[model samples]
Target: MTWAVLLALAGAFCLALGSALQERDAIRAPGASVARIGFLWHLVRRPRWLAGSLAAAAGVCLHLAALSAAPLTIVQPLGVSGLLFAIVLSALFTRRRVRLGQLLAGLAVMAGLAGLVTLFPHSADSPVLPIPVALALTGCVTAVGAAGYLAAHWLPAGARAVLLAVLGGAALGTTSALARVVAARAAADPVSVLDWLTLLAVAVAVFGGLLQQNAYRTGHFAAAYATLLVVDPVVGAGIGVLVLGERVPTTPFDQVLAAGAALLAIAGTAVLARARNRNPEALRPASSPSTDLVHTTPGESS
Candidate 1:
């Protein structure tokens, strides 16, 4: 269990670093369309972006190993640490001072995580759900995510970013669940690389990545990333309980504490988002003269 926790934390750090690096690259790209293949084609040429991809891949491997060793409940919340790591990394790389709100947000997230770890009841030995059940749940999650993606465009800009982020988080959570099952199965027997679940996981990762990049392009990074941090574990926890049959504390006090902790984490994310939006120059794209050009007479120009 200790090893699992350590791996999850390490994975979170890697993911945060990767995301920050990728965001830097993505912001400088010519186009921000989520469905545009050309966007990736442009980004792939950047060495920093490629390095970030490698880091993210490493994180995924670590995350998978952690999932196989421990229960989802334990691993998922720890993944929230990625946001903190990202904020710190951004500050260091940008040589900017961290805001009080950001610091408080980080503390809130950590406190919430600690509360969850202490109050929630998790069993490391829970049996994996049958393949059929997992498939059904995955299908349902995919359908909902698809619906969310389709509906996101109609929303206002900020809301749209958040909705897309939530959908991305859902995709990631579903992929994690599928990965956990595949890892458990592979432990007992050789699993095919071309298995449906494996392919599904790959598809989800791609979809989620596209959504995240779009969010970073179209909205404030803090808002989108915060939404992702909050939504991913929530979706993961639901799947963990319904599909994975993981047990939670049945006591009312413990349930309340867990709920409070979750809310705290979410509220903290909201704070961070607001703070980031207030001062977003670091993440904002450079303004083009054409966009800010004003017509004037020749004398005025002189």
Candidate 2:
């Protein structure tokens, strides 16, 4: 248990660092696709891109380690630290400024994320017929993500990033959920390790990476980070309760408070998303070329 905890923390640290580096690189090289080997090679030629990629790789490794040690519900929410890392580091490293509203949004994300994680039940159980259910859930999540990505045209770049972040969040969240399921089911058999969950994890990691890249491609740093940070946990929490059979707190007051926190997080994300979508009003045309040149102009010409 102690080892598992350590691994999960390591994963979180790596992911947060990777997230910050990814944000910085995205700002510096908007819309550069690293999927193409040639394009990836092109980026690697630059030290910054290479460093960012390395950080991201480290994050992936850490996350896997964390999964080995901790429950997905507990560990996945903690990964929301990426939002704070990206926001603060972006300001420091890239000199990108965050507005007061954005700061408030960040706080909202943290509050909600922390509350949700603390609220998770600490129980372990294995499920029957896990593979089919896991695959079905994955398919449904992927379909929704595809639809959202296709519908991004109606949104501005910032909103687009947020929406895409939601997809990434869902992907990772489901991965965590499935991971726990796999671990529980296979706890008794060594051979159980070789199951559908491993393939799902790989798919989740790959797609999650691409979605993150897409989020950064839109040139809105805060929105991209906040959306991913906020959505991932919310999705994970839902999976914790729904799929894992973990019972949420039953007290009326506690339930109310949790609901309110969820609302705050959702509201904050929506406000930020809308603000990002709303274009600034057109600037007043510059004063017509000065016509009052006056007699001084004629004398000067002479």
Candidate 3:
């Protein structure tokens, strides 16, 4: 269990680094639409972006290893810490001082994670979802994602971004659950790599990436990111309990503490998302002729 926790934290760190690097490059690409195939072409040629991709791939590999050892409930909430990690990394790389709100948010996230780890009991049972259950879960996630995607186009820019991010998070959560099942099966039988579950997971991941990119393009980075932070774990943890049959403390006091901790983590993310830049120069709007071509701080978007 300790190993699993460490792996999850390591994965979160890598993911945060990757997101910061990629978003830095991604924002520089003008006229790149999420709906078009050319959207990522500009980034593909950039060495820094490529390095970010490699880092993200490493994070995924570590995440899969963590899933193989720990229940999704334990792993998913911990993944929320990635945003906290990103804030610190962004400050360091950008040579900016960390804001008080960002520091407080980080502390809140850590407190929540500590509470969860200390209160949640370890489960030795395998997190294997039967085919029927997995199919049902996939169907539900698809329906919700589709709804959110459609609604995004109908809403105002800020709200649209948040809705799109929520959809992205849902897809990501589903992918995580599917990946866990696939990993478990592969450990038992190597042939499980060829299973439909693996293909579905890949498809969901692709779709989620598209949603996330669209959200980034919407220009309300803080709200979109905060929404993703909250939704991803809620969806993932719900599936963990329902599909994976992971157990949590049933006592009222433990339940309250768990819920409070989750809320604190989410509140921390929201606070960090709204954190203002201490550097006045960093706050200036881009003067580029193309409104689409703008640079954003890593902590603000990714």
The sequence of per-residue lDDT tens digits that candidate 3 reaches over residues 103-200 is 67767866665566545655656797777777777787778877776655556545556677888889987887788778778888999889889988
The stretch of ten residues in a row with the least summed lDDT in candidate 2 is 293-302
Q: Please, what are the lDDT tens digits per residue for candidate 1 over residues 1-302? A: 99999999999899888877787666666532233435555668999999998998999789889989988778876877787787777666555677777877877866775576556555555347665776677677668877875665555445656677878888887777777667766776765435777777777767777677756654356667777776766676667777778777699989999889988877876676556442243234333312122121121100
Q: Using Cα atoms with residue i matched to residue i, what is each candidate's TM-score against the true structure?
A: 0.77, 0.71, 0.73
User: lDDT for each of the candidates?
Assistant: 0.68, 0.62, 0.67
Model 3: lDDT to the true structure: 0.67
Error of 3 at 261 (Å): 0.9
Q: Using lDDT, rank the candidates from best to worst.
A: 1, 3, 2
Off by over 4 Å in 2: 1-14, 27-50, 53-82, 127-129, 185-187, 274-302
**What lDDT does candidate 3 reach at residue 138?**
76
**Highest TM-score against the true fold, candidate:** 1
**Model 2 C-alpha lDDT versus the unseen true structure:** 0.62
Which digits, one per residue and each the tens of the lDDT, describe model 2 over residues 184-203?
76778767768777788677
Candidate with maximal lDDT: 1
Give the C-alpha miss distance for residue 236 in model 2, angstroms. Answer: 2.2
Candidate 2: residue pairs that collide: 4-69, 8-66, 11-62
